[model samples]
Target: MEDFFKGRDTGLVIDWTQMPTYNTIMAVAAGAGLIFMYMLGRALVRDRDFRAEGWALTAGVLGFILTATGLHMTLEWPFATYFPFDNIVFGEPSLAFGVLLLAASLFLWKRGDKIVAAEDRAAEAAATARPLGIFVLGMGLALFGIALAGLVFQLFAAPAEEPISGIVADYPMIEAIFMSLLFAFVGLGAALFPIALRGFSSTRPLSGTAKLVGVVWLVTGIIFLLFGAMNFFTHIGLIVNTMQ
Candidate 1:
């Protein structure tokens, strides 16, 4: 029992090569990236048809997955054997994003038909904005705080027990900075959403700030997708190195 506990503490209990869970999680993250890209693009193109139901369903499912994974990480600290701070760095943001996405999904699912069928969709959406909009804006603020924490703490020093850290063991600081920027992009987009939502409600075009937010999401999405894809290779290498 002591040996088992020690192995768990040292991150030696699990065989890294046999566990491809990180790759799977990264793939889900890539899908999430694609969803954000599509959502932001649609928002940018105000005249485009709203596929609310489809997107709502997709986002809800993904949001649920992220929420579950994040909640587990926070409560159980699965992979953060050596550095518990890793749990906060990865878990908190995931939880925030997941909750917001789930809320958005629910809003769309409940009001999708009304939104789609209305002659003035913006007005319909505007009428529907109450607690949900406020909730999202608050979450946006939380994400921003998380981003700031990541930067200030230099969480890139995360130990090898964290999979991504293992993958970039040589350039931890660079990876940390890049990841911090990505979170900042997402946080900025979320924080600016209410302004854009208000613009939509008033039937005004997307403001410069709103358009910039869309662009930020686009860039972040692309980077996440690429990073997730690249991890399939790099993560495997990490595991193999661990085995040796």
Candidate 2:
């Protein structure tokens, strides 16, 4: 048995294909795995009003997916370095944030069984929450505007009339997808913040959907934005170290 096991270990146990289509399919499969888990959890968990959670408190679950993906990417760096250091650059923080999200989700669950909107008297919050939300809306738009301008200039004019050796090369599809996500995240998220603020600041309680939207935007936006900024610092360090 020892001899047989040793022989089996001699060759690679996981020989992945080098085909791009295969790799894309693998990525999609991994994402589908997470969604499957989310759907399963959604079907299983219930609320006080018998409402099963959709994306509520699913950050923790998403965190777990990220953590797994990050670790896998990091570990498989040699075999899976699609764009060079992509794994190390993205994986570590994803693992950390995943853990943080898990802790936060547990705390929410322990305190309130699930994520519940603070339906405090809107009259009480209106004086504070509404104005604050509007302020946040402006800030979000400002940040998004900067990102948009930077991307536009970088993709268009920076190359002196046409983009060269940049994101719009052979990876136009990837670039398009990224731009779409950016627009959706920043535009939709910024758009929702004020409305959510309105709901939160209303004289009456917030609707369930509104509460969900607000919470998703606020929590997800802050977390990912913070993580992204941290990634910039990490990349700078890498560059400095490489130069040294």
Candidate 3:
């Protein structure tokens, strides 16, 4: 077991100066993603009729915020070198938020039966509850799965032996597999956004701003999926080049 473990070597260092400008762009995009997710979550939760929907939206928003913040720090933080855990593992703040969101989501799921039973006594209540339930359930599952996977990858994945070369080399195949799974989960969440929006629109009379936000979420999710797919291709290209 000791032979399988290696001591950390600080000699090799990540050269942030050589990092591409696009990394900054990615950081900004991640920030925007958080803001947008938060806005959508707020809109979903503001109505009294959508309690489940609200909690679900809140969980999703919180999860995205955690993910985006983590990405931003990884990509754009200048002082990452000062903190030993900065890049060695996921950012502590982000991981906390992710875990919180997952807990809230699970809470909602466990209490769903009681809520559904109570709403079944009235026709209007049943009608509204059904759609909200569906949307909330879908969002909860997607967000919780994504967040848990990320947290596991960050906390338990082996660290690199050398600091400068980064952790990618420590467990390259595991990192690749984890990244692929993460992106696929994100894509799954994105794909469900429009469906949730449509369900919300059908069941409730959203304000003009809320409707616009829904549309933006729908469009942005599409764009995010496209960008993610491109990233996948780019990774594949890099792998091929490395092999050559």
Candidate 4:
């Protein structure tokens, strides 16, 4: 029993059965967010004929699904017992790349020749407010770079632990770093959603669906902020608990 307890403490074993029902609820909520985004994307494409933005939104939705699923698995399953490395490849990178592509599409959509004249006028009018736009684009690029680097690191780096039945072990340091990066990117991406929503609201007269999308984006941004804060607090709590 002592050995089992020690293993749990050291992250050699994880017990998912102990998770509270609230955890499951949060997981479901996260999954719903992803699905909502996806459906919205499809609706936009079909109804509004906005193909580029629709694809971008679809990617963002998929990214959210991966992120939510990863979080759910991390909390609901054994961290060390299952294949942790798979989470990094499928969950982290997918979320990051998806968001990056989404952001890129948005950036281009806003600045492409089709809308360049309008965007330029908007830019000139809000020159000072435009810093946020630049920041969003920069953060999107950074996230893509980080995702690429993580993928490379996963490919060439030594396994953190021996594979069990073909499942690769999770490296604590790598997992921590990747999660941190992911959360950072998500937070920034969430911030951009509200900004884009506002832009859409101001410049173009959106139909009922677009209005709903803006509201959803705002709400999702708040949820992502909460999620990021929870992750940060959990990490801090872990460190403090370890010290004791």
Candidate 5:
């Protein structure tokens, strides 16, 4: 019993049962990254504030670094990136990469601050003052509606394997169905954004491809949160028993 407890603390051995708790960290990392990217992009494009956007992007890069490292460390290599997952260690290289990001961001920020003309700045300020609340709100509702439609489809159309089993299962069908659902929901959420924007009480909030980015992000975040939470507590009785 003592050995088992020690193993859990050290991460040398996994319970297999508590996978959900650890994956909560991944969901957070992904969610936070998505939101930050969209927010900073908005500020950069609308305000033309390079310094702020650069720093924000730098921090986001750091987050991805840490999150990717965690994933590699936890598994052999969950993602198929070129980061040499097998060799990623929390060592000098990681620190060096972070330093590099900081330097690049600072350089861009300084350059951006210096280049914009006064007239451009004035125009940007005017643009920022315009109300976008109604536009954003309508988009949010549409994304939710799309996500709900996904849940309804899942409930009625076809059966899916239990969450954990489907995740690590060898069966191709289970994995395929789940991945299909992921694409379905994400696509619907994105596609619905413009349609929702058109039907808004206001004429139009804004226009561009990036307009729907946040809607897709929020929908994805909710989906991950739901799956991670469900899997986490699936074996709650076992969790409590182990604690005792």
Candidate 6:
């Protein structure tokens, strides 16, 4: 039994060829990003009724998906080979984001009625529930740090990895910069959440900062969704290239 188990440990037990797990991860993350946009927009609208429970529930579902996948990627280092650090870059942040979303969703579900708007709910929760707010803010800061690292460290141009590199063989630098910028965009949006939450919570009225957060999330959502969808095709190319 020990000999047999040792033989199995030396080889891959699971097949990844048919499963585009990385792409699925991005797709789920994109979905969560879009939900953030919707939630923010709904919060920003003056006369609209913010359905905190429904939206928080939806976001929680996506958060669970991200958390599961992110935790796996971080711990197992599934697809990353040439650059194992890449897993840390993507996985840790994803895990943190997922946890934040889950936490926020739970709080909103419980004390949602206390908040008049989505922004208010967050701000109110932060004001009342210090820990949750701080956690969200910490995640936002972590994302910002990631964005900074991507820029300062030039993570985009680190190495021409598989599918992404193959897809943008012609314009590698451009695509790399674009990808890095996406991180920056999303990070900026997240970083601003605390500011928006605090600013609007006090006045309990629509504020410019909140509007800015909405715009950022909306743009981030569109870009992330499109990028994630495009990866569906590129990931196939990766599989084919590897097979060849």
Best by TM-score: 1
Q: Candidate 2 on 122-241: residue-level lDDT in tens? A: 333233335556644654565365446435543211111122313244444444445334434544554555565455433355555355554445444454444344434443443333
Q: Candidate 4 on 1-244: residue-level lDDT in tens?
A: 3432234344433232432212223333343444455344334333333334544455455445544555554444433344444444334433443444455446544643343344333333234334545654554455455556555555322222222211223444454454445534444544454355334432445445444544544454455446544544453443333322
lDDT of 6 at 85: 57
Candidates ranked by lDDT, best first? 1, 6, 3, 4, 5, 2
Which one is best on lDDT?
1
Question: lDDT of model 2 at residue 240?
Answer: 34
Residue 137, model 1: Cα distance from true site in angstroms: 3.5
Which residue pairs in candidate 2 have backbone atoms (N, alpha carbon, C) closer than 3 angstroms, thus clashing? none
Question: Quick one: ranking by TM-score, best first?
Answer: 1, 6, 5, 2, 3, 4
- Colliding residue pairs in candidate 1: none
Each model's total of backbone clashes = 0, 0, 3, 0, 0, 0
TM-scores, all models, native as reference: 0.75, 0.36, 0.32, 0.32, 0.39, 0.73
lDDT score at residue 70, model 4, on the 0-100 scale: 51
**Model 4 quality (TM-score):** 0.32
Candidates 2 and 5, the one with greater lDDT: 5
Query: Which regions of candidate 6 fall more than 4 Å away from where they truly are?
Result: 1-23, 37-41, 44-48, 116-133, 151-167, 201-205
- lDDT of candidate model 4 versus the reference: 0.42
Candidate 6 residue lDDT tens string, 80-146: 5444656776777677777767776786688677775444454555465444546656666776776
Off-target runs (Cα >4 Å) in candidate 2 are: 1-59, 71-82, 88-100, 113-174, 177-244
Find the number of clashing residue pairs for candidate 3: 3
Q: Model 6 misses residue 234 by how many Å?
A: 1.4
lDDT (10s digit) by residue, model 3, range 1-244: 2222223343223333432213223423433453445453554444335455555555666565565555565556634444333342334334443544555456455654454345321233234334454544454354455455555555323234323223466665565455435444444544454444443432345445434544544454455445544554454443333321
Q: Which 10-residue window of candidate 3 scores lowest in summed lDDT?
A: 18-27
Q: How high is the CA lDDT of each candidate model?
A: 0.63, 0.41, 0.44, 0.42, 0.42, 0.61
Query: What is candidate 4's CA lDDT for residue 48?
Result: 31
